[model samples]
Target: MLSTPNKQFSIEVTSDSTTVAPPLLSTTTKKLFIPPWKVPETKAPMVFPTCPPSCNKEMSRFNLDGSLKDLGSYGFWVEMCGKLFLFGRRFVNWEQNVEECCKIGMTPIDLELATDVKCINSLIGDDDYRNRFSRYYWTFGLRKTEEVVSSYYWCSSGANITRNWGSGGEPNYVKNASENCVRMEFGRATNMLYLLDSNCGLVSGLSCQGPIIPKTCDSPVCPVYTCRKRDALFKTLADKATKVLIDPSKSGIWVTNDTRLFMISYPSDTKTFVESLAACCAVGLKLLSLHQEVMYSILVGAFNNASIRGEKFWTAATDQGCKKNFGFCSTNRLVRDNARWASEQPDLSTSNGTCLAVSSDGLLHDELCNTKMRYVCEGRAQIPSLLDAVERECAAEFKLTRSEVKALFNSTPDELREKCFLKCYGEGTGLFIDGNLAMDSIFAAFQRITFDDTKRLLDMYSAMDYCTNSSKGMDECDKCGSLLNCGQENSPEEFEEFVETVQLTITESPLILPPVKGVCPEYECIKKPDQVKLLATAKNFTRFIGQAVVLPFVLQLTVVCNKKFYVFATNVERTLSRNLAFCCDRGYRMATIDTKEKYDCMVQNRITTFLNLPPGTTFAVGATRLGKLDRPSWCYSDTEFDFNLAEDFVSNDTLETNYGIAISFEPPLIMKAYETSLHVVCEK
Candidate 1:
């Protein structure tokens, strides 16, 4: 076994110092002049010091020799003081096995020389002590070579010996043969040891060399000062970093420290599933799979920087290019409000301008490529929020007011109101009235009013008329007849006689009735003015009267009348005059006669017969008669009467007397009596 060496020293004798020992010469019986002390030969083997007791325990536990008793079933072993000790039964590769030993406070053995191998072999004993000896096995120490050499060297044993042959033989690292890994082998040539290459990941035994140490792996490595230093460095580095720098042009796998996160920015705004995956690979970040924790870690890493612009970012998870795997994709973090899954087998022929993001909350969110954001990257999936986690967000996005809530009961329509409502509120909200939405308070109030009230209001300002009395029954007279029925008492014979005398005299000789000249002005009567006429005649003790009244009622009202008088011989004319005066007082105008031309000729002839005009006298009868006829006169004088009588005789030869001549000459007396009675009756 290798052992520690002792210190050695040497002594040299020189010529006797000047006269030194003279005092001691007496005993010179062959005592050579030598130094009082001589150096001794120290023989010690080249060995490291004995390891600490803790290290010795760890080394013993990981020993690989069969004599070493196993402590557990994991195939772990240790070596301490050149003795082998075992811990577990399971075999692991050299690197992994070494790591396991280290976890238990032991380190893999460094068998770089033959002495190390000999020392270990001696402690475990030789074949002489056992029924059969096990073949040498490969140790953790390995060699890397590009080609196979004629002689394979054992890094652990530090020799080219065949005693440690693998199951088949020693490895040949000859020229032109590349050897990149090392493996382990066990058993002898007869039994055949197992040989495994490093790259092949074959399982094998492991050994450790050190003091047997019992250490719990939970010991803290980073002191508080070291932690502060690391945190400061992280902050300083992060502050200066403007963007995550990844070289998409390079190709290789990469890993992130726990302090740093990995992210990938796609080269283009949009891409196919295949293209996106390729982009990720170019940046050394594999698209995530369905490992929840890893995915969550990746997302958290992405959002570590608070200065990220977009609230959400994307991840590479779409399986659009995958044929067999469907529904393998990332979900939107804001999906409760804006959730939508891509159409199955989205049309790749068209540009799908969508992008995926891994948000700071450790959730995946998708957005259009034009939207900018920060994102996270991971090797796998993560657990999403629980069902109730996003409820508030969803409610905020979809909440409705009372009016909108009521709309849930109505049917959709085709008009603008309905269309607008649908556009704003989506498909099925109920608030329609007659195909129009009662969306406003005013419109709702209007809809609630009764139809009758609406109609009345529409016609409120119209106007109409009402009748008090119809003109249908009002009396109307056709004409103004003679007003001759005034007297209540008159003999029928007298009345008859009066009427006959007036009619006969006026009809036969209107001129003899004495024309009432200027009764109305000629100019006034010429236009056939509407007139009323009155006739009065008297016989003894009786008077007759007839009157016609003309009433002209138009926009203005007027009345016209004519009155005439006729008398019997004594006092009758006077009685008639009284009646005429009464009629005149009742608004009557007298009728005029025009007989000047004919009557003037007759007057000249009568004058010639009665009395010749004096020799020089110019008898202008036409002038005189015209003058007399034009003047207003109630009665004719004697001369005017005689002339008028003679004129009448010459014109018609019928008027032979001015009055009833000598016939009934004695009637004057009776006539006078009748006239008196007539005057009295007329006066009454």
Candidate 2:
């Protein structure tokens, strides 16, 4: 396999038998770069309407028609290379230029026009005119707040402005002067465009940009391809062997009877977690989710079969919220019973972030989300004939002729065509009900097209449903795309979830039409070592430092309190300080009992049996009358505990008492001295 020098992508070899080689001789670099500024002739200026009373700028600011409200109200409003732009004649502050553009129903020039500085500059015939208008101009790049430090966004599109800043290292905010707005300036020395963060109050010429005019078909009549024509075309294409199909076994990819196709990636072509997620989605799959032990074992066996062991492979288990609660991204539910953490794991240290990866031992370990790692992909293997039949029928219904539809699939689809195709497929597959995704129908469709195991189909439907539901209010086409996006892409949090640009792999792999019978490799489950529960003393506890932010821990507890679990380290003896340290060592917060409901629950239940403690023994809890308060408050985590339920306490308070207690078979919470030894209860 050959990868780019930057490792952004690699050539995918379908079969292990195939080999790829670099060119025997290096080719000459092509120097056919065309400068946008080299235009044949300058376009005529726009004619504007008369200026209104509200306008206070000079007469020259208005167009030749003597009006600022007209089309060319700014400088020279012209369409260049199919995009609309306005070059202003007068100097105006960033805010004023924004208002002026809004007055004309446009936004400040965006990155596209800003990059082609010479094109706009060349439009001016005279050097003086170019220096006056195109030399420097305000753009839509604006940083609204100082809190964000140094990121500017297009005010109109909200896209991050990431052009080559050139040598000046501009977005420096000019020695912290609060230069929160961006303007484009031409470097006379380099003849290149530079995006500089400038003060909003600075005056500069206006440069506004408008949307591109879409290409229109000249013929108004669109010839419809009826079902008869579609079938005939399909027969022709089938006879010619035009459609490329995937056969898993021949391609060295694994498929299981459980309705999941597992695509194993190798170390040579590793990608960051987010990029891996997108890579899988690009081909209609998701990062493998190990939520089920049986699935995990089967995948591990596949790893052994592929000779891809002894390395870390990224899984869908991640705390996408950045919270410590790790869950499978495919399902937003917490990873509780199935979480197999390595020793001292999920420490949330800078090195070990909130993302998860499975080692060769089949145990989950925390890894940075940005770290490059091999990943496994999981999805239902498609039957090529079924997919082709559906695609042909939809293309006919949408009037996307047989050739056009085939070409669209062969290449990367444009926005309009892709959306139209998605709409056709969504409806054709019965996945949509009244223009909305009907999640239940997904299972029915899966059962009809793929394997017919009820349990496996249900699991597949559940994952797809979660992803689709999260994108409910999006456009129909976007929703369809999002269903394919699944994991990190459709997560609730706003994140840099996708790669900056998607590179389309154009070369087609060899095709095999026949269905590959999937076989799961036999795997024997090995018993793993039990986690050692260690006792924490005041001296030894300080060795473990807390995370930068103390996120709520995910607890695995045996006792349930009001549907929430409270874990007790029964193996470790407890002292007021030792108990607190023990919970901290385990990344848990000591149990807090400030609410009346908690007090009542403990009072009603047999506390000794529930906690596996001796009867009449007093256990330590996370409560204290901090700083001369009349009643103690629960203050283990950053969360504030309610003290209004002080009246519900057993009227137990004393000057010597500094710690809270839960007595076995006792109803109300009582206080104990700092040195007091008692059983401890901890919560996440």
Candidate 1 global lDDT: 0.28
Query: TM-scores for all candidates?
Result: 0.18, 0.23
- Cα lDDT tens digits for candidate 1, 329-353: 3220111211233434223331333
TM-score attained by model 1: 0.18
Candidate 2: lDDT over CA atoms?
Answer: 0.46
- In model 1, the worst 10-residue window by lDDT is 461-470
Note the Cα lDDT for every prediction shown. Answer: 0.28, 0.46
Tens-digit per-residue lDDT, 282-373, candidate 2: 44456777654335555666677666657888887766534565666643234555457788887665523367888866778888888898
The top-ranked prediction according to TM-score is 2
Report per-prediction Cα RMSD to one decimal: 70.6, 29.5
